[model samples]
Target: MRIVVLAGGIGGARFLRGLKRAVPDADITVIGNTGDDIHLFGLKVCPDLDTVMYTLGGGIDEEQGWGRADETFHLKEELAAYGVGPDWFGLGDRDFATHIVRTQMLGAGFPLSAVTEALCDRWQPGVRLIPMTDDRVETHVAVTLPDSGSAAGSGERKAVHFQEYWVRLRASVPAEAVVPVGAEQAKPAPGVLEAIAEADVILFPPSNPVVSVGTILAVPGVREAIADAGVPVIGLSPIVGDAPVRGMADKVLAAVGVESTAQAVAEHYGSGLLDGWLVDTVDAGCVERVEAAGIRCRAVPLMMTDTDAAARMAREALTLAEEVRAV
Candidate 1:
């Protein structure tokens, strides 16, 4: 089977791991979100891409669910001592090498897609991982920030990189707006459109829908390619029973003006791009609403508590795809 999956960071990575195990012989292509990519210390960092790479390659830190296993932070510590840092965003020594190599290759004029391929040669992530776009497309959030010296006054609204709002502020502030800067012009990375065109099944794992899958769709032609592909394009809802299974998806969802509910998220994707949608059993009430919106819908276990559980979810997605194709 040929599978194409749109993935974000941790949740996406974990789901890909299970998908690999579920269909061991299937050819999988992951279109990773690059909107979260940020430059730090003059090095480009692709967080979502690295997470998927490490998780699939068995080098991911199991506890943190991101970064490398057996990672050390000597580099981060040294940078902090020099007072040169975005200390809130932890880039350990092991992870730093990845950014260093990527930045070096980027400086040599290699597009991000090519650089990603070279990096994956070492990890052997078991899937063809292509970024959503080789061009720079950053997710920025608008929020209210209190002035540094003002003691008592309404804060001013300001725009910040998605990482700062996520890693530094922890999404505590309301995201008044979420913008995918440059997505309108970003071309799909090499093999992205081809993979979608050839896929037997396409999946939207329970990654943050707004910043992850949504960001990828923001790239020009990507959404149109999948919608017109004439294959089963299914999604597992990240919003399980009215809340995200992981991460602060609700905050971002709100920014997009979508309610934090399985039905609402399915509707957000809509029948245009999605053929089938899966909601957790706890959200069984939403199945009819989603189906009524002209997309096939099912209620299933949606948690990726472990590889086994995630595999089951993968199987369910495949089953749903088959059901959609049969129609």
Candidate 2:
């Protein structure tokens, strides 16, 4: 099978590990979310791409599900001591090397797609990983700054980088708006359209919809390519029981005016783009609601407790894709 997956960070990376184990012989291509890409310490950091690469390359921190395993933070500490701030975002010493290399390659006039391919050369992440766009697209969140003892206290609203809202503020405040800056002008990466055109099955993993998968779709021509591909596009619910399985997906989902429910998410993607949707067993009652919207809905276990569990989810997703195809 020619499988194409739109992937975000931790959840997407972990699910890819499962997808690989589920269909070892399948040709897989990952279109990683670059909306999370940011420049820090004068080095370009592609968080989502690096997460998928590191996880699949067997160098991911298993416990955290991101960053390098056996990672140390001497470099971070040194930077902190020197008053180089933004200490909230932790970049380990080992992980710093990746940003340095990526920034160097990017400075050398290599497009992000080429830079990503070059980085994956060392990791050999199995699947062909490509950025959603070669051009810069950063996810920014509009949030209210914390109240200080002043008249303008809570009235202050500012747009911060997605990482700051996610890592620093920890999604404590509500997100008023989520914007994919530059996405409107960004063109799909070189292979993105071709991969979608050639895909037998396309998947939306249990990544954050608004910022991760949604951001990828924001790139010009990418969503249209998938919708017009004439193949099964299956998605597994990130919301198990009206709440996200991990992370603060609800916060961003609210920003987009989509309810954080399995059925709601399926509806958010809509029947046009998604042919099939999978919900956890606990959400079986909503299957009819999703199916009513013209999407083929199925209830199954959706948790990825381990690689084996993720493999089962992948198989179920593939099975659903087949069912959609049969229809």
Q: Which candidate is the best by TM-score?
A: 2
Candidate 2 per-residue lDDT over residues 48-165, each given as its tens digit = 9999999999999999988999999999999999999889988999999999999999899999999999999999999999999999899999999866776654568999999999
Where does candidate 1 clash, by residue pair?
A: none
Looking at model 2, report the run of 10 residues with the lowest lDDT sum. Answer: 146-155
TM-score of 2: 0.99
Show where candidate 2 strays beyond 4 Å: 150-153
What TM-score do all the candidates reach, one by one? 0.98, 0.99
Q: What is the C-alpha lDDT of each candidate?
A: 0.95, 0.96
Task: Give lDDT tens digits, candidate 1, residues 223-248.
Answer: 99999999999999998879999899
TM-score of 1: 0.98
Question: Which residue runs does candidate 1 get wrong by more than 4 Å?
Answer: 148-153
**Candidate 1, after superposition: displacement of residue 56 in Å?**
0.2
- Candidate 2 pairs with clashing backbones: none
